[model samples]
Target: MEMNRELIVLINARLVGTDPQYHRQIVSHELRENAVWIGAQLHGKDGTATIRTVAALLHVSPSTVSRWFQPGEFERECEYLSHAFKADGSLKPSIPGRGSGTGNDGQ
Candidate 1:
């Protein structure tokens, strides 16, 4: 996957500091967080965002981005569908079921 050069530059610009080491640390953290934010924005109600897409955009490893979607990681901020992402790093169709039904119950 190709990285988004513009986004990378933007993120790096935001991390400019006197300490190069510290800047690198902050950049890594910020990039990971931004990856999650981007994922959430692109995820939509249909889980359209794939891990590889987010990682590629943020210049991070797909596995690293994938970890953020794991249980207890960012569950409160965004819901990650367990079966949504396929092995090929693409999103599968999201089919609503069970609790996803109308609130009126089986009237």
Candidate 2:
């Protein structure tokens, strides 16, 4: 959403009054918590990073990623990683660019 002038002013004013420590603890952590840790083990085998890059590395189709991951899956992952990651995390496949269209991630 585009921020209007009033909203920008409010954000600026709030920032002015906000303590650096409190801002870091309150805002930064929340942003970090939502960010996908694509470098983590279950995120991808090698050095996969970012959702788009992970999808590319895994070769899983973009639609498949969107569907299986319900948008917030990464956020949940940032909060709680699980052992059933890769196995249970399996998603439906995309048509050729060429692959099984089963579980194969074009890899």
Candidate 3:
């Protein structure tokens, strides 16, 4: 979907008076969580989030995401997804001259 400038304005206004970096971090983390949850709903086999689904959304391999689920695996992280979200939170495929859209971006 096309970005709603008005909505972005409203959200940014509400975020005023708070640390911009902190808010950005929070939004980044939340977006990743949301993506994982949505991916789970679509591809999980047991009504739970799966590495394969989340990996697909993050543009990574299943093994990369699975490594994060391992016990005592703090070294692995969702840094890629965080950065990706910061770059573009839409989580849609981009096409030249046509903003990201599974089918349409309201353009």
- Under the 3 Å rule for N, CA and C atoms, how many clashes does model 3 have? 0
**Residue-level lDDT for 66 in candidate 1:** 68
The better-scoring model by lDDT among 1 and 2 is 1
Of 2 and 3, which scores higher on TM-score?
3
> Using Cα atoms with residue i matched to residue i, what is each candidate's TM-score against the true structure?
0.44, 0.29, 0.30
Number of the top lDDT candidate: 1
Candidate 2, superposed: residue stretches over 4 Å from native: 1-39, 42-49, 82-107
Residues 19-99 of candidate 2: C-alpha lDDT, one tens digit per residue: 667765665454343334432444433333356654565565556445445566654663344332453344334455555
Q: Model 2 lDDT vs. the true structure?
A: 0.50
How well is each residue in 4-77 modelled by candidate 1, as lDDT tens digits? 99877777677674468888778777876777666656654455656788789887798877665566465334
Q: Quote the lDDT for 76 in model 1.
A: 39
Q: Looking at candidate 3, what is the lDDT of residue 82?
A: 34
Ranking by lDDT: 1, 3, 2
Report the number of the highest-TM-score candidate. Answer: 1
Clashing pairs for predicted structure model 1, backbone only: none
Question: Alpha-carbon error at 31 in model 3, in Å?
Answer: 0.4
By TM-score, the better pick of 1 and 3 is: 1
